[model samples]
Target: MARLLALLGSINIGGNRVKMADLKAAFADEGFGDVQTVAASGNAILSDDREPVFIETQLERILADRFGFKSCVMVRTRDEVARAVADNPFHGEGPQHGSDKMVHSIFLSQQPQQSAFDDLLELHKSKGSERLALGTRVLYLDYVYRVGVSDLSNKFLERKLGVKGTARNMNSLKNILSKMDAE
Candidate 1:
C-alpha cells in the first residue's frame, strides 16, 4: 500500500479541538494502516492503496461520526507534497518573502479556474499584505506579517474559491514530509 498525507481542515481550532491520539485511533479504527498524526494540527500519514478521493470522503465521515464536526480532508501522495513544496514560489528562497511560518500551502479540494484565481486576488488586494499564487490544487500564501493579525481566513478563502481546503505552514509541511519519507 502507498503512504499518503491527509491534511485535515478545522482541526484543533475554532472549538473543534481534537486530540492527536484520538484522531489516530479514528483512522486506525476505520482500517487505515500505519496511521500516525503529526504536529497536532490534523496532519496524518497512513498507508492505503485506495484513491485519494475515496479516502477523503471516508475521513470526513469518520471525523463527523467520531468528533461531531465536519471537516475537509485533502489526501495527497508523497510526490504530490514534494511537488507542492517545490512549486511554492515563496519558500524562503529570498528576502522578499516571510519566514516559513508565514508561508503556507493551502491544499485545495479541486483545481480552481484561472478566472477564480484572478477574482480571488482582486478581492484580496486590499485585505492584507499577503501574496498569493495558484498551483496544482494548491494555493500558495505568503503572510507578510503575523498570522494572528491577518484578516484572511479559511472561511473567506473557501467562499472566494468555492472549494474546501486545508492550510499548513511550510515548516510543518517539511516536517511531515520528512516523516513521510523516513517511513
Candidate 2:
C-alpha cells in the first residue's frame, strides 16, 4: 500500500456537512488503513492498495453517489508534496508578511503548458492586486489585500485558467509536507 494525501473539494461548504469522522469511516470501509483527516477542510492521509488516480476516481464516485454531488479531488504522493514546497518561488521575505493570507499555492492535475502561464499572467494583470509565480505543478499567488476580499482567490484562478485545482495556505502546505516527512 502507498501513503497518499488527498485534498477533497468542498462537499459540504454550503451546509451539507460531511463530517471528517464520516469521511474517515468511508475510507476505512473502502479498505483504506491509517485513514486520518488533517482538518475539517477535507485533507486526508491514507494508505490504499490502488494507484492514486484510481483512488481519486473511486473516491469521487463514492462521494457523488453517497452525497449526491461532484467534488474535485487532488491527489499527490508524499514526495510530490515535499517537492512542491521546496520548489515554491516566493519562499523568501515576500510571503512572511501579514498579507501572506493572500499568498496561495495551487496544486494542478498536471504541469500546465507554457502558454498557460502567459494566459494566467494576463488574467492576473486584470486583477491588478495579485502577483503570480508559476512553478512546475503549483502556482504561487501574492495578493495586495486579504485573500477573501482579494480578486485572486482560487475561484478567480480556476475561472481564468479553466483548470481544476485547490488552494492551501502556506502554513497548511508546510504542515502537510511535514506530516509526510515524519512518516
By lDDT, the best candidate is 1
lDDT, candidate 1, 15-83, per-residue tens? 899999999998999999999889888999999999999999999999999999999999999999998
| TM-scores for candidates 1 onward, in order | 0.94, 0.87
Supply candidate 2's per-residue lDDT for 39: 70
Model 2 misplaced stretches (Cα beyond 4 Å)? 92-100
The top-ranked prediction according to TM-score is 1
lDDT by residue for model 2 (1-183), tens? 778998887755876479889888987887788987887887889887677888889888878876677888888888877766677665543544643444567887666776877887886576576677778667777664567677665666776666778777666777877776666
Task: Mark the 10 consecutive residues where model 1 has the least summed lDDT.
Answer: 92-101
lDDT of each: 0.90, 0.74
Residue pairs clashing in model 2 are: none
- Model 2 superposed RMSD (Cα): 2.2
